[model samples]
Target: MSILAEEQIERFFNVLNQSSEIIQKSKDQSYLDSLIEVLDTVQSGDVQALNLAKADTTAVSDIYATFNRDDYDSEVLRKAIQMAVLKAIKVDKIQANYQITPDTIANVVGYLIAGIFNGHRQLSLLDPAMGTGNLLTAVANQLSNSIGVKLSVSGIENDDAMFELAASSFELQHIHAELFHEDTIQNVLAPMVDVALSDLPVGYYPIDANTKGYNTRSTTGHSYVHHLMIEFAMNHVNKGGFGFFLVPSQIFKTSEAKQLLKWMQGHVYLQGLLNLPTELFSNKASQKAIMILQNTGGGAKQAKQIMLGEFPSFKDQTAFQKFLTEIDDWQRNDLLQ
Candidate 1:
C-alpha cells in the first residue's frame, strides 16, 4: 500500500507545481499545508487512516504499515522515494539494503546524482538487493531533476519480505520492475540487479593439468543465502553507461572485494571511490565504498585505473557542486582520458 494516498499526493503535486510558478511563498505553503494534512492522515497505522484516506491498498500495503506515523514528514517521504529509485540501478556489484539509515540514503542520493550526470546518453538503473526501495526512489527523484537520467531500471532480491516491500514501493511510484525472488548473480537479465555471494574458495592448484597455478579465488558455488551481490547494470546502458552503487563497502577495501575489483576492472572502467561514513551502516563494519564504473566498447586501451577520493558528507543538492569540482580537478589533471 502506498504510504500516502496517490490521489491525495497527486493533488499536492498539482498544487505545489501551481504554487512554484508564482512568487508567493504563502501560496506554496498553502499547497504544502494541504500535503501535510494528507501526510497526517496517512501517517498513522490505524486502519482508520487507511480507510479514511481511502488509499490504494495495493500500493500502500508494504512499508507503510511499518511507518511510524509520528515519523511522517517531508523528509520521511523524500527518503523513502530516494531509497526506492537508487537501489534499482544497473551495476555489477552491491545491493542497497533498506536497513540503511535515512542519512545514508540522503548522502548517497546526492552524491549519486552529482557524480553521474556528466555524460549525455542518460542512465540505466538497477538495485539488486532493494530493501524498502530507498535507493531506487532517490535515483528516480535525482534523475527526474537532472539533465541525464533517462534510463529504465530492474532488480532482484531473494528475501520475500524485502522483495514485497520493494515491489510495493515501485508500483506506488508508477515505476516498473523486473524484480525476482532469486539470487542476484544466478540471473543475468536485468535493467540492473545484484546477487549476494558468500564463501570464496581460493586455490593454488595448476589450471587443469597444463598450466601453472595463478593463485585464484573463485565463487564457483554460491550458497542460496550467501551469494555475491553482482550488480548487473544493463538498462539499455550503452558501452559508456555509468553506475553508482552502495554494495558491501568491503568490496573495494578488503581481500573479499579485491578479486571482485580485479574482475570488475576487466568489465568496466573504475572511476572514483568514496569512502562511506562509518555511522551509516547497521552492521558493526561501517567501512564501505562507492564505486563508479563505465563500460567502454573495445576499440581503445582499457582503463588501467580511475580516480578514487572522498565525497562531501552532506544531504543537500548543493553538495553536488563540491563533487563536480573534485571530478573537474581530477579531469584537469588528465587522470581520466
Candidate 2:
C-alpha cells in the first residue's frame, strides 16, 4: 500500500528536475540548503516554506515555494529530497570521505540480509559507517518490500555532512533509525541486535595507549582500524545474530589481521567470506571482501567451517540477479534445516 505508482515516481523526478532548474537560477542559495529547507517545511508543515519564500535573499524562493501545495504530493517531494541528498553526495559536492557504498553492492547486501532472516518478523540492524544511510536504507527498503515494515536500525557516522544527510533521509523515508554522529570506537554502543552491517572507513583513529581493547601491535604495525570497528559492532549482537562487513582483503592475508580473525573465530561462528570486485568503489583502488560472522555465544560447538565465494562484478545486473537467487535458495535450505 505504501508503494508509489510508476507515474507518481516519474512525476517525482520531474519535480526534482524543475526544482533543480529553479535552484540553478538562484546564485545565493544552494540546492542542498533549499532542498533541506523544503523537506523541513514539508515534514514540519509550518510557515517556514513561506518565510523562506518571502525573504529577498535570492532570485527564487525555497524549493517548495513555486509548487502549488493544494495538489502537491508530499510523498513525492519527500522522496525527491531524499534523492537530492544522495545525488549531492554522489557528485562529490559533499565530502563522503570516499566511504559510500555503490548502489549495486548495497542492493546485494540488502538482499543477503533479507534472505538470511526471511522468517524474522522484527530485526535490529547496525551500520558502523553509515554514509548517507544508503546501505541500511537499502536493507530497510528490501525488508519493507518483502514484509511491509522496516527494521529497527541503529547506525554510527563520524562525518557531520554524512550524518545530517543520513538523518534527513531516514526521516523523509519514514525509516525507524537512531543515528549516532560520533566516532564508533570512541563512542559506547550497548544495544544488541539481530544483524550488523558496515562498510568500514579505511583510516586510523588515535587510540589511548592504556585503553582496554587497544592492541599496540595491531594498531601501530598495520592499521587495524577496521578490526576495531568490526569488534565494536560484533559486541552489539544477540546470541544468534549475524554481521556483514566490507573490509580490505588483507584481513585474510596479513599476520595481524589473521590474529584478529582467529580471535573472532573463538567468540563467534565465522560463517563465510565473499570477495568483492577490486573496482567496486570508484574513489578507492582497494581489493575488498565481505566478512560474514554469526554470534555463537561462546559455545564450543558453534564454530563451523567457513564457506568462501567471490562475487562477480555487481554492476552486471544479470550476474547480481543470479547471485541473489542462489543466496535465496541457500538461505531457505540452510536456515530451514
Candidate 3:
C-alpha cells in the first residue's frame, strides 16, 4: 500500500473503532454488532445507530462525519474495514470459521480469476461462504480495475453477524451484490454464476436430511461440510464455469475422498490444485491449497498438463514472479486452448 492509502486506512479505522465503542457500551451489544451499526451509519450518513443505542447523537455524528468515503479507494476502505472486523472477532471470540480470508490468499484468488476470464467484458461471481465480504470485494475490485469488467456478485452467509457485516461492508464499498442469509446446503436457489469461489469452511455438516441428494453426502455419518459445499457451489455454476476453492491440502486423502471423487467424475474437470505456501499456516494440518475446477461442458476439458505445484514463499520475489509467469504460460498453452 502507498503511504496515502495507509494513512487513509488508519484514519478511517480509528473512526470506526470510536463509533463502535460508543454503540457497544450504550446498547450492551457485542463489538461486531456495534461495528456493523457504525458501518451502516457511515454508508447511509444517517445515525440509525441512535435508534438502537443511547449514544449521544452529536458525538456519534461527529465520529461518522470524519469518514468521508471519497477519500479512500475501495481497496483501502476494505482493508480498514477488515482491520475493524478482525478486532471485533478478537473481542467477540467468534468461532474459527468466522476468521477473515487473509489478503494474501484473496489476492492470489483474484489474480487467478482475472487471468482465466481476462477477455470477458462482464462476469458473474458467487461465494457460497462469504464470511464478511472481504474475499468477494477484493476479487471484484481487482476484476473491475484490472480488466474493466462489469461484475455481478452474490454471496451466502448463514451466521447473522457475518451476514450483516457482509451486507454493511458491501454497501460501504458500493459493491452491488446479491446476498442471502441462508444455509447454502439447504438453499440451492442461487443464480447460475459464471464463476464460483469460496474459502470452504471445514467441518462435518450436521443436517443429514438436507444431504439426501448431494453426491458428497456420507454413507455412514455426517458428511464433511466442505465437501458438500464444493458440490453445492458447483451445481450453481454455469456450464463450463469455473470454481476456485481454498481447501485443506489433504482434502483428497481423507475418508470422505471417495465420495468427493465420485462427484468429480463427469460432473467437473479437476483443472489444478496448487498448494499454498506452508508458512502461511500454523501447522501442517492447517495448511490449504487452491483447487481449480471447471464444469464439464461448453468446451471445457482437462488441461493438457494440470497446473500443479507449491508456491514459493511470497518473500522470495524472484521465485514468486517465476511461478506466476509459469501460470500465465499454462493458461495460454493448456487451459485456454
Best by lDDT: 3
lDDT of 3 by residue, 110-211 (tens): 999999999899899999999898999999998899889999999999988889889988888889999999999996588999999999999899999999
lDDT of each candidate versus the true structure: 0.45, 0.65, 0.91
Off by over 4 Å in 2: 1-38, 45-83, 90-99, 148-150, 208-211, 214-222, 278-285, 298-305, 314-319, 332-337
Candidate whose TM-score is highest: 3
Candidates' TM-scores? 0.55, 0.78, 0.97
Model 2 is weakest, by summed lDDT over 10 consecutive residues, at 55-64
lDDT string for model 1 (1-337, tens) is 2646554444433332332222123233332232222333333433344332233333343324544434333334554443333332221123443243354454455544544454635454566555555556556555555555464666666666456655655554556656667654444455422211111112222223221121123433222121133323422245655555554455545444555555465565666566655545466465556655566553423345566655555444467467767666664453345
> Candidate 3 — which pairs collide?
none
Task: Please give the lDDT score for candidate 1.
Answer: 0.45
Score residue 13 of candidate 1 by CA lDDT.
38
Decide which is better by lDDT, 2 or 3: 3
